[model samples]
Target chain A: MLISNMEIIPGKQIQKHFGLVQGSSVRAKHVGRDIMASLKNIFGGELKGYTELLQESRDEAMDRMQQQAHAIGANAILNVRFSTSSVAQGAAEIYVYGTAVILE
Target chain B: MIELTIFLVLMTLGYLVGQYAEKKHYQSIIEREKRLSGLTTVASRFPPPGKQHDQCLVLGSVVISVDYFKRFIAMLRNLFGGRITSYEALLDRARRESLLRMKEQAAKMGAEYVFNVKYETASISKGRQNTIGSVEVLAYGTALMRPRDEA
Candidate 1:
């Protein structure tokens, strides 16, 4: 629950090493977005479709990571990082990872 | 002369297509590599975190960066606009890869847990922003072995 930029909390205590937990999500948008984006390449407008896709994937991956942390009874996670990749021609993968830590 | 011109044109076209495919493929590989970066190996034995352990271990995490220059110029085309910039792609990959490397290191160290992790992102370009950057994410934690009472 408590998220900090640093590893050790200034005053908080942590206990029990939860096995390293991670979560990943795969997402895709209408090829329509790519088509529209190409057009925007000339007009230079926003790519709304990919934006929505990334947002959705971000939440999903975080949720999965949290669930894994919960199973380990971690009160919080540290050193969280995110990554993305194209899994296929049309799909993309988003992954999140961190060390699960709990206050004793 | 005609054959030479035709050959040049074909090469140019091939280069264009290859450029696009490379971005997609390379980014995916980096992401997968990040996903698997953490410790997959099981520890034979170790005390859990928060126990009254004497020996403490620390870990640092970092993400590898790919700045603009290193990527294709057209990817530069993707930068100024687009929902997803090529820079975002590289940063994302770096984040994943760095974390994986940290986890691997922690597992190797035989630490029960990695605590106090830190992430440091630098240009690695000396001072230029136009460069294909490197993100070094450092993860550090105190590793300790505790007695049964501490657990």
Candidate 2:
């Protein structure tokens, strides 16, 4: 399904709106990754392990959102947004939401 | 005495390695920024005036952690309650890097301008006392995809 943050798609037209659809995932850092991260932290740099983890989590969340859109018989999601929060120590929650719509 | 030695060792390690890492990151950011200069990024919720084109959602995220030395310094700074330059630099880098990544994603999707850009930031904690272990930055926007022949 097509996904965008713009309220209106240029080529396509919105035929029907299915309201809001959302997906979320909560992830925590493992001991091994944390060990590696701490070592890298001594040098101050990007934590590749954590980056990869978050990326995966985001993709998963997006996938779930798509699934919701598909279940609702919508062809697209619009005005998509992402939010992150620290739910626990070493853990993060990612939420993605958008309006499901039928595009033609 | 042993504590002093460990602190010295960690401080030197942070100084040497952190400096190298920061330099490398800065160079990388500059290079990417130059490469993506063709794409426009704006914070306004409204799209730029132009021939209506397609639009897509694009996002980029990054996580950065401070060095041990910087954390230690920050802890000390807490006592005096002053701006921590070390953390300031770390956060600045994270923010810019995430934006660059978002631009890269938009460019890949054949979008010329990224509009309605937004940023979300969260701090991951490590200890019970709420010590910030790492910071995550998420940048997202709508990319206005124009016709390929418009150029």
Candidate 3:
């Protein structure tokens, strides 16, 4: 299925709207990675480990949202948005939502 | 006394190294921004009309941690109730770097324009005593690409 953040696809039209479909995942950092991150914190640089971790989580969330759209017989998802929140220490929740629709 | 000495050492190290890294990053960001200026980015909710193009989602994210010295300064600023310039710079760098990375990805995919761009910022770890440990910035957009046959 096609996923986009724009409200309208350039040349296509939406036939049906399935409202909002959302997915979320909560993940905690590995202990080893945390140690490395702390060390990096002293020097104030990018945390590659955390970046990869969050990216993975976000992709997973998007996949789940796509699955939901598929289950509802939608051909595309539009107006997609993402959010991240700290659920607890060392753990974060990646949430994504979009409107599922059938395009013609 | 030993703890105080250790704090001082870490603060000095953070100040010197963090400043150097920030300068280098800014330089690189500026250079890349110039190179990538051709890949236009916009926050409009819809793509321009009359173009039949393939579209896909693209994103870039980064996590940046605060250095010891900067964190200390932020703490002091907290007491005074004014702008935290150190953290401000940190966030500014993170935002620009994230957008650049997103543009780089779109360019790699042969996209000519990015639309509906959005940004999300989250504090990953608050650290002990309520200090921000690290911040994550994510920029996402829909990339409009020429049709395969045309490109």
The candidate maximizing lDDT is 3
lDDT to native, each model: 0.52, 0.86, 0.92
- Chain A TM-score per model, please list them: 0.83, 0.96, 0.98
Ranking by DockQ: 3, 2, 1
TM-score of chain A of 1: 0.83
Off by over 4 Å in 3: B147-151
Q: Write the per-residue lDDT of candidate 2 for residues B1-151, one digit (tens) a residue.
A: 9999988999999888888889899999999999999898987776655476777788888999888888888889989998988889889999999999999988888887898889888886655456565788889988888766686
| lDDT of model 3 at position B36 | 98
In model 3, what is the error at residue A57, expressed in angstroms? 0.5
lDDT of 3 by residue, A1-104 (tens): 99999899877889999999999999999999999998888889899999999999999999999999999999999999999999888999999999999999
Superior candidate under lDDT, 1 versus 2: 2
Model 1 whole-model lDDT (C-alpha atoms): 0.52
DockQ, model 3, C-alpha based: 0.81
lDDT of 3 by residue, B1-151 (tens): 9999999999999999999988998999999999999999998887888879999999999999888899999999889999998888889989999999999999999998999899999998865788876899999999999777676
